[model samples]
Target: MGEIRQRFTDEFKEQTVRYIQEQTKTIPQIAEELSIPAGTLQRWMSTHRKFENEPLLDREAIRQKDKQIHDQELEIEDLKEEIAILKKAMHIFSKERN
Candidate 1:
């Protein structure tokens, strides 16, 4: 396999990660849209959790975080639904073939 190379600067990485965290899109979707690895964005987000001074999160920011959490929960539900559908389809197909 070829080595992976990074093309974006630190500012770009930070902005992309912040956008990913704040947006309604799933991590996979964000990665696909931004052309960055989901794992890389995920790791960046983990690192961001240790901010010493975040300028004191305002009520709006708190609301935004709540929204982000809700969005992630929805995404997880969607993924679970998709997995269930796939499993059901697979079982039916397997029975039909047997």
Candidate 2:
């Protein structure tokens, strides 16, 4: 009798790939631990290798970027308010001199 084929979900595959990437364990060791074939894990790793060189942003980094953007937006609003106030002041001064 032939062995039934096992299927894994995309989430499982992605977590497994991330684990393989982050762990110090060898592929064979991880495969054995997970009861999956080394070849399957290797194939997943190979597919992920394409984006391995790209920098992945962690949650903290993303949060910091978001804060920076928010701060910049506030600064922009403040500058716009200052510009309007300066323009109003210039108009008042010109009227007084006229």
Candidate 3:
């Protein structure tokens, strides 16, 4: 009969990676404590490193969106000013015709 394989949740894997990053313990020591293979823990750390740049990407995207919103607001203000000028011109022409 084959031995059953153990499964771990993504949350558990992420927490383990974080613990490894925050501590000075050796990989073998942590693996012994957690009763998992050191290679498995190391693999998790490798995966975490790959995704770590995601936050930086997210911040850059947010900055671009904020800039877009600011530009749109300025455009709206300019349009409003143009509308006011047109209204004043209409008033002036109406009085000239009276």
Alpha carbon lDDT of each predicted model: 0.77, 0.84, 0.83
Best by lDDT: 2
Question: For model 3, which pairs clash?
Answer: none
Q: What is the TM-score of each candidate against the true structure?
A: 0.44, 0.49, 0.48
How do the residues 1-98 of candidate 3 rate in per-residue lDDT, one tens digit apiece? 99888999988898888777665578899999999999999998888644442333357778998999999999999999999999999998889553
Model 2 shows how many backbone clashes?
0
Candidate 2 error regions (>4 Å) = 49-98
lDDT of 1 by residue, 1-98 (tens): 99879777777777776676566667899889877788988887776543533343378978999999999999999999999999999998888452
Between candidates 2 and 3, the TM-score winner: 2
lDDT of 2 by residue, 1-98 (tens): 99999998877888788888777678999999999999999998877544453343478878998999999999999999999999999998888552
Candidate 2, residue 55: the lDDT equals 42
lDDT of 1 at 49: 44
Native-referenced Cα lDDT, model 3: 0.83
Backbone clashes under 3 angstroms, per model? 0, 0, 0
